[model samples]
Target: MNYNKLVKQKRVIIERCFGQMKCRFHILQYVCRIKLENVPKIIIACIVLHNVAKSLGDPDFELVEQDPDEDEGNHENDELPLRQLGQQINKKKLEYYNK
Candidate 1:
């Protein structure tokens, strides 16, 4: 029932949804070539299609496993940038909760 725990749980669900979407809608796995303003509409359409397919009992395509070495580079180099971004987000979340 902790707020942090609830946020983590919701994040897991969201990540799972994205993973499934990427598998079923291969376009999602690639860089979107459309205008940034149109991105949300595209994502919404994909969600609708995904849900409809689920309702119809369509099976999800299995996610193709990529070599981690090919996609994910050295995490050590990313740590500083990620930490800075995470700090900003954490600050905003804390402010929202403190309100």
Candidate 2:
């Protein structure tokens, strides 16, 4: 199997983990205003709690979408640069992994 293909396939697991985390912890779905240094700690705490819930055989709930009308903020303008950077990083990773 091509390394890229294998990596892409494995990516779904982490993506699903993120999805599940967002579903379990709605805070993950929205922008959190806090000190920059605490962001990782918050996310790590969520991950730890999520794992604990899973380990305890908690029921998995599907993500429920909030009303579209309630979302008034346009985030595309904010995400464009971040998305571009992510693409650049992904390309670099692919280059390194394919070598």
- Computed on alpha carbons, the lDDT of every model, listed in order, comes to 0.79, 0.80
Misplaced by over 4 Å in model 1 are 62-99
Lowest summed lDDT window (length 10), candidate 1: 54-63
Colliding pairs, model 2: none
- Model 1: per-residue Cα lDDT over 1-99, one tens digit each: 999999999999888888999887888899978899998998899999888666545556555778877966577978898788667656655665587
| Candidate 2 local lDDT, 1-99, one digit each (tens) | 999999999999889899999988888899988888998998999998787666545556566788978968887698888788667656655665587
Which structure among the candidates has the greatest TM-score?
2
Clashes of each: 0, 0
Which ranges in model 2 have alpha carbons more than 4 Å from their true place? 64-99
TM accuracy, model 1: 0.57
Q: What 10-residue stretch in candidate 2 is worst by lDDT?
A: 52-61
